[model samples]
Target: NDPLLGVPIPEVTSEQSSSMASPQSNVQTNHPMTHHNNKWTKDHPLNYIIGPLSRPVSTRLQLHEQALFCYYDAFLTSVEPKTYKEALTQACWIEAMQEELSEFERLEIWELVPRPDKVMVITLKWIYKVKLDKLGGILKNKARLVACGYRQEEGIDFEESFAPVARLEAIRIFLAYAAHRNMVVYQMDVKTAFLNGYLREDVYVSQPDGFVDPNNPNHVYKLKKALYGLKQAPRA
Candidate 1:
């Protein structure tokens, strides 16, 4: 919901521009018969044809272009790799991972500690998302490393799991009131919001995949603040 949460739009390079334009010209000249078959021909006796299209029908647009035309399914189908191994193959996801870890370090969310005995250690995984704008432009590529909170023991690791979020009906009512009162309504989002909360109970989690310290490969992170996917994170 945050305005800034989106995949970074890539700059159009001269090579890409030339490549995209080259296909349209070639397709028009080579596929005359294809266009002839696709042109409108009305069935009703009284119906008449409209003027020809101003330009030749373009070769089918690329997936991203289709998405820009508001084809939701086309946008959704854009490939997103599932695992760290897969994500590393793409530059976008690699940058996303770097940004996430940088934020974690900036927030001082946790500290590396020697793995303790007799206590359960929760695992973590990376979640990949391709955030888009209303018009279907990529806004951001997000990679979140979240704890496996379901593995947590309720009595020992977490006791509460409650958090408040804005209700849609409530938001509508507030907007209506503001409109009637001739007041502007503004909204704000807290980046890393959950991490702002202090954790009451000690929680230990395994090192993130691909980021384990070489010297402390067996060490775990002792969380001082709530993290995403922790059951008590919202309540904290």
Candidate 2:
């Protein structure tokens, strides 16, 4: 009787079952628990334990198990870098930084210029992050070159510090309205958000570490758009 092919097991006779059912009965019953030996699978109440079933696994079942393991293996993710120095040493982090710089250039976030006299040039730092999917698997590595906005003066760098953010109640109301109208809701991801906001103040920042140009080592980046760390970035 093969278990893998769903073959039915041979049922014991009613007379043999009655003898095995009684705990006080001393009569022996023909219950084939062991394979041709009485060395294992004892019928004692104290020592009675179900043993491993001897079954044949088909080739298809073996392949399916292998495929299941491979599918879950994709969720394995790498660790995030702690600093720019650590990030520069790895190829994956270098690619992430490159992607960030490319987006900045595409958006015309800053322009290269000589260091202005008596001007406060903010230093930039590389922020490393591991972007993950909903299932917790790594989607990609994220790098952001952010300005030191803490050095910014209230009136000089920014005026009003405010960003329009939706409230919890407003979100709930919107969801309720959408449900009432039978709307199909979809999420839109804004990759480079603050970088797209136009900057009113002339914010100058040092070139990103590890990617500093040899030709313009003393040059600073005059920001044309809002930076990540800027107080007025979300407002802009």
Candidate 3:
């Protein structure tokens, strides 16, 4: 026999039946009544909860599509050459290197002098690289003249070679301090950073390849300022 069998059924009054049938009365049902109603219903709790979820998914999809379109547009723009002169200049690596060497000499990074007796002279060479923009487009050609510092003897050729440089944390701290003081920060770069440092030791370097002095081909350079690839060059 069932436990609820033989239990007396309570008679429903007119007011109680009316209240039970009303929509407001359904909302006021206890937890047990609501749970039982949901179990028998076709619509589950998850169905109602998922109604507001479509908006963020749609927004994210639109953002991804927009980013892809922008990337494609930028790629096509970079692939299209802007002018005929730019196209021609891009093919001239030797000319670019020569021009860079001329600029380096004009900046007075070193003085052309006779190769001194019993003094070690570092060999120099031209290094070529292509400059690129943030969007991966070729911006310009770059040429650097670097010295072979491996041949340099530590104490005999140079002394006290280490140069101090500001760390990234120090730079961040400086910017934060400036911001706290409510000041605007500006940035400027030296055209040739190594060329600005005064050299204490007597250092000499050979003329860059393909750029021998027209009047004095036999002479080497006595460096007054630091050169790229020098072991003791100062850092800015």
lDDT-sorted candidate list, best first: 1, 2, 3
By TM-score rank, best first, the candidates go: 2, 1, 3
- lDDT (Cα, tens digit) per residue for candidate 2, span 101-142: 999889998999999999889998988888889997788888
How does candidate 3 fare on TM-score?
0.57
lDDT of 2: 0.81
Model 3, 27-67: lDDT tens digits are 64455453345233335465566555444434668899989
* Candidate 3 Cα RMSD (Å): 17.7
Top candidate by lDDT:
1
Compared with the true structure, model 2 gives a TM-score of 0.62
lDDT of 3: 0.73
Tens digit of per-residue lDDT, candidate 1, span 137-176: 7788899999989888778888878997899999899999
Point out where model 1 deviates above 4 Å. 1-77, 166-184
Q: Cα miss at 148, model 3 (Å)? A: 0.4
